[model samples]
Target: MASSADDVFTAICGGTFVYPAVMHEQYQDIRVTNRDGVTLGSIREITYGHAISRMVSRATEEITRIDHTSRTIESRFKPNALSTFNEFIGSDLLRDPSEVVGQNL
Candidate 1:
């Protein structure tokens, strides 16, 4: 039975002819072939780890963009609604209406 790392490596390599080496220093043993079955390159053992990190970084960037866009839209609309309400009720509407009711107790 293959280990989890072996499965991950196989999936990334996309072939059954390759094998994962026990020694991390032997990363060069993992062969990568081109479509024409020619040796292209050998990825270092750290390559997979780097790939995963890059994916996480991209996801975080997209999330930040979404959050910033949402806040900008909210800021633009909130002031418009407040201004419209103030205009409808007169600029002094923000003041206490109790003064007009004659209840200065």
Candidate 2:
């Protein structure tokens, strides 16, 4: 059975044939070749640990860009929402709500 890494390598290499990998070395060299055995490119193995970190970093960057774009689009419709929120917090609404019953008792 081909491992997940092998699948990923095969996909990245544009549907090329992935040669039988040698497992002795610290890294797995995925020889990318066409159907007729023409070498296309070299695929290097990434450890599972490093792959997780790289995936997380990439996801975080994409999420940040999405969040920023959405916030900008929303702000265009409600430009004063943020400032109003800040003003409300800065005002005495937090200190005295006028509905509390007994405070000095």
Candidate 3:
């Protein structure tokens, strides 16, 4: 294990509603060991990059879905929904998780 990448990925996939609980459960099973059967490190780096990439992909999908839904709603009924969707798509908080994953091995 290298970093808490798996936790981050789980959080993203589960969405805002369930990520917190799933992350806590996953964290409990994380561990590290060496060749001699000795505990060397306890970081969660085993799937960091994969997790980050998954998060980025999922975020992109979510943004796309929101954009489509907003456009449909605006064209058919409500205009105010566009503003909310735009705000969510434009927010700086939803960043690519891959950038946070370390590259050095």
lDDT of each: 0.21, 0.21, 0.22
For all the candidates, what are their Cα RMSDs to the real structure?
A: 28.4, 25.0, 18.8
Model 3: CA > 4 A from native: 1-30, 33-45, 56-99, 102-105
lDDT of 1 by residue, 3-104 (tens): 233453444334332222122321211222222111122222111111111110000000111123332210110111121111111122333423211112
lDDT of 2 by residue, 1-105 (tens): 112334543443244222222122212212222221112222232221111121100000000111223322111111122221111111123433122221111
| Candidate 1 accuracy as TM-score | 0.14
List the lowest-lDDT window of 10 residues for candidate 1: 55-64
Pairs with steric clashes in candidate 1? none
Question: For residue 75, what is the lDDT in candidate 3?
Answer: 11
Q: Count the backbone clashes (under 3 Å) in each candidate.
A: 0, 0, 2
Cα error, candidate 1, residue 97 (Å) = 76
The all-Cα superposition gives candidate 3 an RMSD in Å to the true structure of 18.8
Better of 2 and 3 by lDDT: 3
Off by over 4 Å in 1: 1-3, 15-105
Q: lDDT for model 2, on a 0 to 1 scale?
A: 0.21
Error of 2 at 11 (Å): 0.4
The number of the candidate with the highest TM-score is 2
